[model samples]
Target: MSGLLHPFIQLGYGLEFKCEALIACALAQASTHRKQFSRALDTETFDEIRAGDLDGGNGLSLLDIMELMRIDPITDKITYDDDPYTEENRALSQTLAIKYAKLWSVGNSESSVREKSIEVMSVIALVYGSLTRPGYRPVLEFGVMHNLTSSYFLPILLDALPLHKKVRLLHAYAFTFIYIFATKGCPPLHIPPELTLADTHRAESAESSSSGNPWMEVIDKAIANNDMHVAKVVRALWRLSLLTAFPTQPNASKGYELPPYINCLYLARITVDSINMSTRRDSVTDKLQLTAQDGRRNWAHGMVAYDEFWAKYGQAL
Candidate 1:
């Protein structure tokens, strides 16, 4: 019990507690004071886990509590749900926890900027599942984090991985997480019941045919129009695509460069839900252009803010 309970105690205490303290507390509660530890794993545990107030591990980790309670030699009811803890639920919860913990740990580890960035990216990739709507669904629909954090993780994570790895991971993570998010229309931080593999694949195929292929379509249109401005926008989009292909700076010379394509993307975003012929033309007008200086400033500001944020609360990542 002490061994199994240690992670929970650590997580409940926000992992800020020392290992020795965690051991002491867990043993003291579960063994010396069995009543207290039992209560700790009861309804009270749910709030701490939900709030992320726990320490070394997530409060609801399958390995830490759910699995132990379900798979133990004992045969008593454990979960808050009225239903008994079934093998299926236990397995699903454990799979989720293990993957969640690994990525969460990476985003929380003590490492260099480059290493930390890579880990963060990997974590995002793991969460997103693919580059399409299917991959992004789980994270976005989970609403566990705001769309800003949830949607951005993939692009950022791809920045950290090796160029070769990023492309593949991006495809997988983006497709899975995006599919979860877009279809469900949920916020980033929430979680849903089990999502089937078939539904996810179907969503991926549909998105690939239309929305995911928007850039190439736009480029083709730009080429036919002989529009330099539109051509530049396409070029920028092409560059932004590279960012996902190779997320992080490989060396000193390969520092961050803002992709100019986002201007058109953002413009598209502001008007996607509404369709006015005049407004559409106006949005595409020359004034809609985004300048390099604007891009540089925005990139620099974001980078500085991210670095500062990590430097201050890096342990929590």
Candidate 2:
């Protein structure tokens, strides 16, 4: 992983490296990347990577690799979704975990910021490249899960993106990777309750009934606990995934403003200068309730912005 990202980072695709690598890896597979990688990880071969068919190549999910290495157990609480991870791939995952762990540490460290950042991107490439094979893991790991987008990693990533004109491309590319990984991959072929940004709107729904707007609360207790099966998650993901590569900003003049979040869904993963708005303190429970008189407000419209965004960019990559 130390030198894996070197090719992409040098090409100024740091932020976009994962996306680019995802495409490259997918093309290498069967001319498609993991159905666009969860639209998760795509690789050198397609038939060998799908679940339940480990015949042609090595079939190891990231969890299997990590469990084989005995790493990330504390931070990543996940189960083996496939067959028992045998001793065959044990050595491979261990070697990967070593490089994976190094990248994780360097990514968070403040020392040698620039070099460390390059190494981080390289590791992403290296790891993803490795997974392009049959025996490799298929999704992001504990430190790499896109769902952690809302957590401390965002700030760390923000810090890594130096505020320099010459290096702005790095920020963009880095963000591109962050955007998809966060929104798309939760668990392999599954979107956990937390991964769906739609639920973030739902989390704030109950509170919207009162004076406080739906956008006020970012993560609602209810939404976090809400669980849907993989089938529904996959369908929603497909509709949303194929609709747009990048998430869009709202046209609304005002709405509740939750804690600030970076929008790297579209913007070529260039800069944090995308857009930051102060949403008005209002919410509509449904499309019909978009603008009610006294207490007919709803948060469905809050969710509409995203739905419409995918529709708007429906034909894009």
Best by lDDT: 1
Question: For model 2, how does the per-residue alpha-carbon lDDT over 79-183 read when each residue is reduced to its tens digit?
Answer: 222211223222233323332222221122233234323323322322221221123222223223222221113223345455342133233233334322222
Q: Runs in model 2 with CA error above 4 Å?
A: 1-81, 97-218, 221-224, 227-317
As a TM-score, model 2 comes out at 0.21
TM-score of each model, paired residue for residue: 0.21, 0.21
RMSD, candidate 1, Å: 20.8
lDDT of each: 0.29, 0.26
What is the per-residue lDDT of model 1 for residues 222-307, given as tens digits with 9 covering 90 to 100? Answer: 45432233343334334333443343532211322211112223322212211111211235564644233211111111111123
At residue 261, candidate 1 shows an lDDT of: 15
Q: Measured by TM-score, how close is model 1 to the native structure?
A: 0.21
